[model samples]
Target: MVKSYHPETLEEALKILVETHCIPYAGGTDLMVRYRQGPGLVPNFDRPVMFIGHFPELTAISEKNGEFSIGACVPYRDIIRHPHTPEILRQACSLIGAPAIQNLGTMGGNICNASPAGDTLPPLSVLDATLTLRSVSGERKVSFLSFFTGPGKSILRDDELLTCIHFRLPHFTVEGYRKVGTRKANALSKIAFAGFMLKEKDMLSDVRIALGAVAPTIVRSRELENRLIGQPVAELAELMPDLLKSYGKLIQPITDQRSDANYRKTVSLRLIKNFVLKEES
Candidate 1:
């Protein structure tokens, strides 16, 4: 028999999650579709489910001293509307489904889903995000870059709940985000790319680039970005070929339902090249 739990508090929810073998339920935008059992039929819940979507502890959004903390269960709609949300993140959230899915989908769910094509992952990666995972034992923060192990896989334990995400927007003046998909609305990304740059006195100080749906994980190479730091922004054009080659070597996109490997890689590199070498505006 299957069981369901709706804990009144986040603590109770964490307790139940640890005490029972169950899946954490939130938004259910992905779980419902994944466990669907046919029209009008209850989705199959093989073990148990503990509902945490309504916990206020997992739905707040706030910023302090330029650092922002977003509750794990915050819906995309709220993130899209939050004033302090980075423009890249806000734009990615707005592109996520129609208003309906945005209203129901949470960024925590998106991270936990660990889909390579998730539109928000690229932005989160380049933003240098951190995830807070909690359980009855305690909570710990992990870098967004280290959270996922593979497609639909993450280090999140059954006993743990993702509580919030934290990140500081770097003092970057140039930022870009792009998502390629079959359709403009409610479409999953074929390839997602995000880049950020900070320049001072014609010299590059920071550069971050993340590519999604093109690898086992969202691809980001701080090593590569660091190599370009201190170089004059105008020189990026001279380094385009080598830079794209390095980025191309980093991404391992696969041919799947939405796109081919070659196309994903080519388009992603093109986006990066454009971001770095385009004329200043």
Candidate 2:
């Protein structure tokens, strides 16, 4: 029989994880859906399951120094409503699923799901978010860029729980997020893009671009960013072709049910171009 553990404390959760090796459960939006079994369509808990969604330690949102720490179980609706949430992240959260899903879906679950089309990832990547993971042994922080190893995979240890996502509060002069999907709402992304640009006078000083659902993981090219930074925004039109070509070379989208590779490539490039040309107001 499948064993289930619901711990009220982070310490108890960590202990259970270390001992029983249970599948961590939060939200259950992805887990329950993926585990539906047989013609009867009952949810399967093939392995031991542990519920960590209600732990107070994993549900707090706080700020320290210049960084904001979002607890692992904070749902999309809470993130969308939070006053200090970054605009890019807020916009991304607002676009995730519909009202019911948003209310129950946690960012930690989204990150752990490791879907290539995850709406929150591109924005988190652009923000340079870090994840704090805690295990029975101790805790460690990992960059969001290094977190995912591939589609549906991450570096999370079986005994560790992701505690919080941390990032410096973004202060971009202009920032934007765009996701290409079949419909405006409740659709998975074919390609998604998030960009942050810091304008110093008439030149772009700091520029970060992240693309999602176009690779095994969210893709950010520092080499491309280096090429744009310190360049005058007025010259963006002249430089766009090469930039687009560079992005075309970097993205390796696959043909999937939601979209074809060619279409993803075309739309992703166009979105990048549009992002560069947008003016801060």
Candidate 3:
């Protein structure tokens, strides 16, 4: 039988995490599905489980010093409804799943799960979020961009608990998120894109683009973005084809059950093109 621990406080949770090296359980939406035997049944566990979803410290959302700090256990529904939540993130959260799932699922869980197709990842990537990880020893911050090593993988240690995710507030002329999936809701993305741009007198100054479900992890290219920044908005349409071609070379999608590589590639570029055009208008 698997042992279970429920800690009321984050400090207690970190102690449990370091001492027992148990699996952190928050929301358990993905974990349960991965361990499920069948319908109307609980997942069988082979290791100790630490339930940390309801800890008060991990459920708050606050803003300070031009940064928005969201607790690891803040549910998707809460983020979607929170007045201070970034619009791009709120939009992503609103599309995650059905209402019940949204109410139970969390941003930290989503980040820790590290699914390449995770709905929230692209937006987080574009936002340049950072994660605060706490262990009995101390706390450390990890850039969201470098957190994921591959699909369903992250640099998080067994003794560490992700406490919060935060990012500087973005100022963009236009921001967009697009996810191509089988259905509008309750479906995994085939190809997803999130983009934001800062324009000064019709010249792009800051441009960020993040693509999901197209690689081992969420993909962002500073090199490619540099090529577009400081360029006139009027030149964007003429430059799009080459940009898409360059992105196509970098994004190596596979033929998975959810989607084929060709389709994912085609749709990914189309979405990028549409995003640029929308910003141009």
TM-scores of the models, in the order given: 0.97, 0.97, 0.96
lDDT of 2 by residue, 83-173 (tens): 9999899999998889999989999999999998999999999999999999989999999999999999999998899999999999989
* Residue range 1-281, candidate 1, lDDT tens digits: 55889999999898888888689978889999999999989898788987788988899999999999999999999999998999999999999978999999999999999998888899999989999999899999999989999999999988899999999966787888888888989789998889888888999888899988999988999888987899998787888888888888888899978899999888888888888875545
lDDT of each: 0.89, 0.91, 0.89
Ordered by lDDT, highest first, the candidates read 2, 1, 3
Which regions of candidate 1 deviate over 4 angstroms?
Answer: none
lDDT of 3 by residue, 1-281 (tens): 56889887888988888887788988999888888889876678777899999887799999988889999999998899888888889988988988989989998989999999998999999999999998889989989999999999999999898999999988898899887889988988998889998888989898999999998899899988998998998998998879998999878898989999999888888888888767443
Models ranked on TM-score: 1, 2, 3
Supply the TM-score for candidate 1.
0.97
Which residue pairs in model 3 clash with each other? Answer: none
RMSD of 3: 1.3
lDDT-best of 2 and 3: 2
Q: Determine which window of 10 residues in candidate 3 has minimal summed lDDT.
A: 272-281
